[model samples]
Target: MTVHSALPDAGWAFTDDAGPAVTRLLDTLPVRPRLLGLGEPIHGEELFLRVRNRLLRHLVEHEGYRSIALESDCLAGLVVDEYVAGGPGSLDDVMARGISHGWGAFAGNRELVAWMREYNQGRPDGDRLRFYGFDAPTEMMYAQSPRHSLTEVRDHLTAWGDAGQLPDDAALIDDLAGADDRWTDEAAAMDPSRSVGSSPEAVRLRLLADDLRALLMAQAPRLLATAPEADRWRARLHARAASGLLRYHAVMAAASPSRYARLMVTRDTMMAENLLGIAAREADRGPTLVFAHNAHLQREEGHWRSDYLDQALIWWTAGAIAAAELGDRYAFVATAVGAIHHRGLGAPAADTLEGVLSTLPDDPYLLAGRRLATALRTADLAPVRRSDNTDDHGFFPRDPAHIADSDGILFLRDVPTDKP
Candidate 1:
């Protein structure tokens, strides 16, 4: 069933008014979602980021959003948050220390950070914008060792109360952790046999992590009472990161058939936890704008074909889990582009969503979720394009079935890189 001819008229109807376009899209949502997620089909494209920056400005200025969370390392994001909140630091240093995945070098990100700092200047603490990274510390190339988080939690706790109250096992954890190179071995990603997950040291470390987590929970009341609220919050963050990173490492070392699946799920689980924590900390004060890839923020099950494993794996995204927990309070707006000249992508096929959207003028627009879904269901939406080159690949199809799961769509008829 080719949708090339049966496709609905361009229902987006957005024109020169980008702000109003965004407003109309948000109005269609069943509820005002707290987490207003904006997903880019590809990464590091200045076009997408520029649109994102525009929409984010509108959301913050008009819609009362106070925080912006990215797909970078959650723990490392503290440096960014501090800078944005009026802490002292040069832009260059903040960008270097704050962003991960080597994204600090992005022109769009640099612009975004600079704008954030400028916007924050002279603003009261209550009015200052916050920045965050909701991703786990782990990356595709390396899963971070648990030492940092564990040590942080221990140090924070020790500062507030009796040092003896906490377990005295830093040396043991260090020994068990071994060299960072072992945990970061790229070969271990494909060959489970190469993983040290099943090693006796790893098993023991898991037990220790569980105990430490339990101890944190058990001692929370006392810890909170004795420490400043700020200190307590920081301690909790460390505890959660410590426990979560340990679990991630444990999964990485697993010899089970489901190791990879568990590993993916674990990463998203931690992402969800971090996002929820961000939401909880802020409460009903102000909305948050989350920036990530479409896969991480979409409500549908995320699928990726593992080149090494020779099979596809499906996992729940952070957005999917948040929707289950937050319901209508979580909203998502996925960005799709019609063309990316650098990546061999051209105009969208008439049957595809991008193609359908291409009929509109060359500008950023937002489409109603239900309307887009209806059009897609009738138009025979294209199949999803699974690839390892997600950062650079421009063409990605949207499964029509998942359209309704999103709150809205942000479409750009053409994507041009901001690179020199």
Candidate 2:
């Protein structure tokens, strides 16, 4: 077995340009934050995930961070959270059922959950770690039906049994929800005409969902008094996801040119809201680590371009939205890579950000985003260029504009096809 040691003070100071790799996360930003977003350029590769696991373990041990949130289904994550918090279930069951988007298949994620479970075995409540999913239940292919989220809200609020102004008939939700396949139909994503989003039943269901969510909030005080913290938090999350699903479907049903753009914006909006809720929940514990793609996590206008769309899609990223409200309480670290061998990518030209960073001795290192951006602006090392190496693969290179607003950056010189 390979032994991994995460010394708290291993790397924080970048002595000169491209010094030793940064190992600590807290002091990289201007202020200590409750939420720190760590972004990856692409998904599915275990290299970035292993690095993420290492960084998170370091933060948990040294920086007083108690939670780690992923870009997965929030509802599904509650199950993983329960498993890690010493609730009933085998590791295999939790991995298969609890995690969303097939992320459980990733060895690094399984390792992360196992580590968290093991770490929480005897720790005090305050010191124990928690897992969270901050993304919307929707996906690029299909948006899950609001059936589970809505029913969960109803069941939680029913703890009061006779709560004032709450939806009484669960049958109404079920009847309106109709069939699950109607909502999960992947074809509806591309063809709006087939979507059941704008139908009268859906519209009514949206209103009912809104009412149920409001009722949950109105009766929050009573629920908190009777229920545990986890139950109350999850009830609220279900409400949020239900409402977000309704809104996402509404947009998905639109036949306009900006349909996909609206979908992206709505998905990210749900993500930002989920993260904010997560921050609130973990406020009493300690800081949190939020991990996702660079586009979803950057503290700037999020952009997605395609040859099919007449115009590029643009909206605020989850990090940008959350940071606006969090102020100094939020920080971001974007990961950039020089090469991805599996994607047939190779060395970056000396003129790009990845190219210059690749020249450093460190295999993977952290740079203060602002200072790095400043240094690059003076053209001391090389003239910067927007990365073109990622045109083929989903992998993206760091842009000069992105670094200024970010707190720090984790850059890898090369990406091996196999797990590191």
Candidate 3:
């Protein structure tokens, strides 16, 4: 069967090799989303990042994509965005300060930013590419201080907001924030008692965060009239970070059984909001390519289990939220990898989705979501074998059920993590 044609009867046949021919696969999607999400099975894999760069380059050249959003810090991304848009700064400097969660250390990310900058040389604004970091600044067991976001929004209000609506004393926010360690304490994640979120000062800060958000909205007309695009974006970004951190801290202080569940849900909610904002901003320019973990971008409810949690937590992911609102305008393409020998991961079991794809000659094959799921299933959906690789590496195997949940799947025979 040709790559351009539909699935065959004798088993799935390769068509496009997940290269520039990815355009063919994307053209088959039901709708061209303003935000096209590409999810990876794990983070920090050089191969996945490189593949994303390649696919996005193709999309920019062939499909008119103008922006790329990553799972890094939204606030930190602005620096990278500015650099890519011809702002002054060396690539090394931008990589260190512009990317969060230590993702800048990855060579692949540096290449992506450098390429975006090079691509923008002498190009007009509309045709030049854009960059964004959509994930909240929260981690599994560590959440950052909300002081910067809180203070930034507060400053914005003082500069533009009406006096009567503003906080009585601007310094109060700084006082309430107390110390950075109170919020950044790693122990707070596993033990809520260590959190200062429910303290009197922290509660006041939460209320202040809410007030700041409302004030920004109420004064949007005045602010927008006076503020430039960058100012407006920064104000909104600060507002989002402030609000998200307050909510996350509140969860951290709760000694309830659903602590981790609430934390995970809160983090993804922030991601979803940022994604929606990106969609709105890029609606006129062109489509965007969002890259993140498979769990964050899948349309199905996110589920996780660990010794820390008593029950299996199921919550809506960013993709589910975006899909509910954007409908056909949001599409998810999941990447299924065959093996990463370096991580002790071997070839996929013949019964698994990755295993089935390993049988094909195409190193990377683009398969239809629903059709492939049906073809691979006999009676009920057989579970995709969970990775036998050590858990410390953070590898997640394809959940057979999720293959049908996605709009498409890009299967790779090997990630070449050992590097050629």
lDDT of all predictions: 0.75, 0.80, 0.81
Measured against the true structure, the TM-scores of the candidates, in listed sequence, are: 0.89, 0.91, 0.92
Clashing pairs in 3: 3-15
On a 0 to 1 TM-score scale, where does candidate 3 land against the true structure? 0.92
- lDDT by residue for model 2 over 141-206, one digit each (tens)? 899999888888888877753455675555588888999999999999889988989989789889
lDDT score of residue 171 within candidate 2? 51
Give the lDDT ranking, best first: 3, 2, 1
Best-performing candidate as measured by lDDT: 3
Which digits, one per residue and each the tens of the lDDT, describe model 1 over residues 1-420? 434332233234455446777777777877787888888887777777667777778888998988899999987888888887778989899888889988888878888888888899998877888888889887785677667777677676667765666665644777887876776777777676666666787677667666666776787777777887656766667767767777776676667777777888998988898888888876756988999998889999988766566667799999999888888889988887777767767666766667677766446667777776765565655665333345443335566667777788777777665574
lDDT, residue 325, candidate 3: 92
Against the true structure, whose TM-score is highest? Answer: 3
Q: Give the candidate order by descending TM-score.
A: 3, 2, 1
